[model samples]
Target: MFESVMWLIVVAGGPLLLALLMAYVLMTRRHRGPAERMESDRATKRLYSQDER
Candidate 1:
């Protein structure tokens, strides 16, 4: 019974942990300042432009 309960907790916690991590990432990303966002955008554009060569 103890092992079964542990297994169930682990199974339920996996998705909960993943969801928390994803939410944290999304919240941080959404709160970036304009300059920081612009820098990220510029970096992405630079990377893609280099890839086209």
Candidate 2:
């Protein structure tokens, strides 16, 4: 009985957790625009130096 209850929780919670994660990732993804593009470019450049391959 205890094992069945735990299994059900895992089955239900796994999809619920996955859906929430997907929603968060989709919602927070970068938006397209000149300003946003420039900021993103700058961030990438700052993080990865062009001099190194």
Candidate 3:
């Protein structure tokens, strides 16, 4: 009985979790503009610069 209940939760929750993650990814991609993304990428590259030494 306990095993069956755990299996039921896993089956239902897995898809729900995947759907939420997909929605989050889509929303974030839509929210950021191209210029904003470029600036973020530049900032990240500057932060990790190996020539600073």
Candidate 4:
């Protein structure tokens, strides 16, 4: 039936979609190490500043 085929497509594509998302995140993160670290440091600074205000 059409519903079964649609369900099969959804089930079959789930892992492939997840793998693609993981790969994309990993690839982008490889070039963003310094930027991500800086963001974390800035966030920490803001947290401490807010406490002092």
Which candidate has the top score in TM-score? Answer: 2
Task: After the best TM-score superposition of candidate 4, give how far the Cα of residue 1 lies from its true spot, in angstroms.
Answer: 2.1
Please give the lDDT score at residue 8 for candidate 2: 95
Please, what are the lDDT tens digits per residue for candidate 4 over residues 1-53?
99999999899889889999999998887555888999989999999999999
TM per candidate: 0.54, 0.57, 0.51, 0.50
Model 2, 11-41: lDDT tens digits are: 9999999999999999999779999999999
Report the lDDT tens digits of candidate 3 across residue range 1-53: 99999998899989999999999998888567899999999998988895575
The better-scoring model by TM-score among 1 and 2 is 2
Task: Please give the ranking of all candidate structures by TM-score, highest first, separated by commas.
Answer: 2, 1, 3, 4
Cα-based RMSD of candidate 4: 3.6
| Candidate 2 segments exceeding 4 Å error | 35-53
lDDT of the structure predicted as candidate 1: 0.94
User: What is the Cα-based TM-score of model 1?
Assistant: 0.54
| lDDT comparing candidate 4 with the true structure | 0.91
Candidate 3 TM-score versus the reference: 0.51
